[model samples]
Target: MEVMQKCCVLFKPDTESKEMSGDSLLEVQRAKRAANLRESLFQILSGLYGIMIVILGAVIPITEIFMSEEIDSTFEGFYIYLYSVSILFLVYVYAYLLRRNRLKTELLTRTLSRSLSSSRAWAKGLARPDTDTKSKFRKRMISLDVSNHHTGTFYLRLGVLGFGIGSMIHSGLNFGSFVSVSGGDCSEPVQWVKPLIHLMFTFFQLYFIFMNSKMCIHRYKKLARFGLVHMCSTNICVWFRSIVVETLHVIHHSDTRGHHGAESGHHPASDNSTHARSYPHSAVGHGISHHGSPGPEYVIHDEGMEKTLVDNMSHVHHISRKLLAASVNASGNISSASKDNCHWKNMMSQAVEEAGPYLYPCTIEYSLMCAGILYIMWTNVGKRPRRPTRSELETDSEDDGVEDEQRAQRMSVDCTSSSRGLFLGILLMVGTIISIIAFYMLVNQEEMQDSAIFLTHMSGTFIYTVTLLALLLAAARMKNLSFHNQQEANLEDILILISYTGLLVFIIFSLIASILAETSTMSTLTILSNVSMLLQATVQTIFMLAGDRMFAATEKQVRKKPGREFITFLLISNFAMWAINTFQTQTPQHNPIQVDFYGPEAWAIFTHISVPLGIYYRFHSTVCFSNIWKNAWKKRKHA
Candidate 1:
């Protein structure tokens, strides 16, 4: 009877274990299904929100361009609409975060209070010390889950802040230009409201990004994803708008310049035939004598010249109408465009117009930076914090040690380490400055304009050639060093490649234009410049990628790092290239070969699309090279 009872007890435990196992399996399946459902919902909602924002972006610009009656009213309404929507969304997200933080705080407080009360009740008549109770409470508090806030590195944050400041300055200038317009009421609410809202949006949006760039949302995933995607789309929309406006401005100015040149009879020798071919009647009528009497030839001249003048004048009139409309308020009060306006207001307007080229780029850069940050935030939504395994922890520790060593090395690095490269870069920079000054000064003179263009292109060719040689040498040196193979491209590399496409596009077009255009000194220089840029970009990309993957091959070579000097030179050269492109290359007047070959409108379009990207590539390359110079080398300690 005892043996039978023992057998029954063992069988009973086995049955119970099987039941528990089955229940656990069911629970796991249910959890997985819930997770999968949540993921699907999130993805569906995200797609809907993205499509809505994209449609909004497309619709707003089209409406502003085609549907608006007056320029000032249209711009004012656009700003108000954009600012309102953006501010509302920003406030929504900000409020949500605040509420979440408050709830977390309250939960912690209540739990602590309950634990303390229980402890006090249990020890009411006991001899337990208060210190021990307090210690236990503190331990419990410390053991609670604390979230990890993965804010990015300090320099990246600083760069974003700096770009934001530039954008704010641009907005501030626009506000001043708007409010200081003559014949506009200083107290008019509509006149100043748009810019005020703009300023506020810029301030708040920048603050939000700075504070929460790396925030990961695990709860309220839908709302978080919506807000982040909206902000990203908004930035992209703004960037597109800015680019379009700048392109239009360029085209307008180019048309004006072309008209002025035709009126002044200062066309380039090669372009005169093209212009004559375009306006054959004007060519035929030019032989007539200029007099007040209406002879047959004089009558013909009047007809042809009038035809040409009317065509040119109509384009100019269209541009003027737009400009004048922008200066007039909704109340029909004309601002600086009118002869009756105040001289001071006119001066301010002119200054703003002149500064637009420089300010526009800043705004473009700002929007791009914001969009990138928001994209990162969007991708991080609903992600949970992962605990590192033992092997990963050890790897992290080793990486930390390497970082510390690199920091020490960077601190010890000085001019002596790269004196030759530094001096050469400084020399090149000084020469570039001189060349730029000379080019700008001469470009305004009718006879010296060609010379100025020649000098600019030649300077570009020289810089690119030198940089290409340096990159090649650096590549060869890198081949001697061993590096770990990186199977996947990182974010920086991906961005570099994307930006590089712009440069490549510009280069290819320029090369094609040079080949098809009449052979001249300018065309030859352009071909050289474009070729050098292409090769240099290719070699530099390889060099940077290889440098990024560099690791110590042996303990003996740990203290020696090559290519720092080359990187220093390349960094400065890229900055020089950026400045050149920003100031000189974008001007349609600078590359008359392209203008003559592709026509002013087509050339302007090409430049507007590509020059900004090229400028960004150079700027970003400098940042990358600086990083490589600072952090690529680390010393290993041997036991």
Candidate 2:
């Protein structure tokens, strides 16, 4: 039997250098439980705060009316400004991500590391891995195990931010909406749907906060040390520092750097630079030059210079025995042979494998929690959208350096399929516009409003379908500008047309089932958002499946970049949609017009879809970055 033990001691200084024997995984589990409990407290606090804020917003109007003062100024001063700050802060996070990405690419091209290559193929026929001359960091990442991956940790504290905001502002907005419904006489409106939506969405935000909080605590605790009190875990600080503040992971992934500081991106000898033309193609290891140094400015490739860290296994078995005993309460100790073999090694091996990857919780888990909250809050797919920041597109993109012309050219997609889909979708869109127009016309007018309303119903439904298809067409057009395939432009337009047509038809029926409340009641402007989220998820799944199959057929030889535009649109649309619904439900003139955006029974479907979607998208981007980091190490060698 192999007693549980640590394999390494960097220095033989006895007690201080002992191998890690305690159950770190067990600690993580405990952290998760603690995070959940804290989240529950936050939820309670958030609920109370939301109610207070809502009350404040509601009462201020009545207070102003009594005090005989201009109430609008107070709202503009505090509510609008505060809300704008939070929204802008959210936008800043995204801008930071894009900036980090460009820097990451530059970094990877310069980084070099000792971990860079293998000859005669390491995995044999099982995996057609990248060539021996490729950056070593990329090699290590491909063989990475799950649990080591930094995605999906924030399941506990997902919706807290929104919950807190909603609780604080919901009542104020609701009362204001009531005032609007009552023609500003400081009287409540008779509408039941808006109040219902508010209550339901409050619960939804609570749920989101709970999930992310839990995941955060688990990940955060991973940074805590085994013995010393207040000996800060480098992991927590590094991850949070980067993600929330500096975007460290983003840089690491763009271009991998080595401990010794080596360039990780492709390098070819200056001599060979003239021999081959074009990037990716020239760097690709199909041909070798006779007189080239390792390449570009410097270096060379050699198999014997490389080494695998997992070549020995005396300590792996020991670690496995202890972890198993801790997790499962096993009676018998693990055997040495089996430890070195598959029997005991499998679980430990899996853990060991995953240890490097799941270093931090990523964005997918964060989004899933949000989606879950949405699912809990609403019966329908639509919410009043925040007035689309029509001006934001002009200013923000320039600062972020995203080209307006590029976006415009992409939007003006030339293919008939894309335009035709929009055209076909327009019939559906017109119906929606008519419905919205009819809704407003009814809001102000008093003549037989109820009777004429039903007359425009079918038109509204058709417009819902067309609007969805139009957005789908728009999203696909954005996707094509990233790639360089001639046939793909036509194929994508066709695929988008078909996909939208199918989705539009499917989602319209879903709304039919949700006919209890006129989705228009929630927010007339945001009806198109439903189409956006659903389509984004579906498209991602389709591509992921395709990528999987492609890799399977080629044995990991698939050489395509994942869809960047789709991911960008998918995330912004999803998050912005969720966050902006608050803007939709609130009217600036009133303290806030109250309505529930996330309800329990129906919208939980969105939550279920989105939480996982957000988490995966964010984490996957991180993982993709991990693959991109190719450390440059020539400086250390020269030193």
TM-score of each: 0.74, 0.23
C-alpha lDDT of all candidate models, in order = 0.62, 0.29
lDDT of 2: 0.29
Over the stretch 1-639, how does candidate 2's per-residue lDDT look in tens digits?
A: 133333334244454434332356678889999976875555455445444544554453323322222222232233333233333432432244223333223222212111212211221211343566245423221111111112211212223343234332433333333333322212212222333333343344343223211111111121111101111111112112212211212212222222113333344333423232222111221121211122232222432321121222223323332222111000112222223222333443343223212212222232223433222221111111122132221111112122556535533432222343334334433444454455556544656444333333334334334334433543453342222222122112222233334334434533432342334432232333344435544554344223211211121111122233223333233332222222111111110001121212122233222222233342232222122111000011110
Which residue pairs collide, candidate 1? none
Clashes of each: 0, 87
Count backbone overlaps in model 1. Answer: 0
- Provide C-alpha RMSD values for all models, in order: 10.3, 33.6
Instruction: Looking at model 1, report the run of 10 residues with the lowest lDDT sum.
Output: 141-150
- Runs in model 1 deviating more than 4 A are 1-21, 68-85, 88-156, 182-192, 255-344, 385-410, 413-415, 635-639
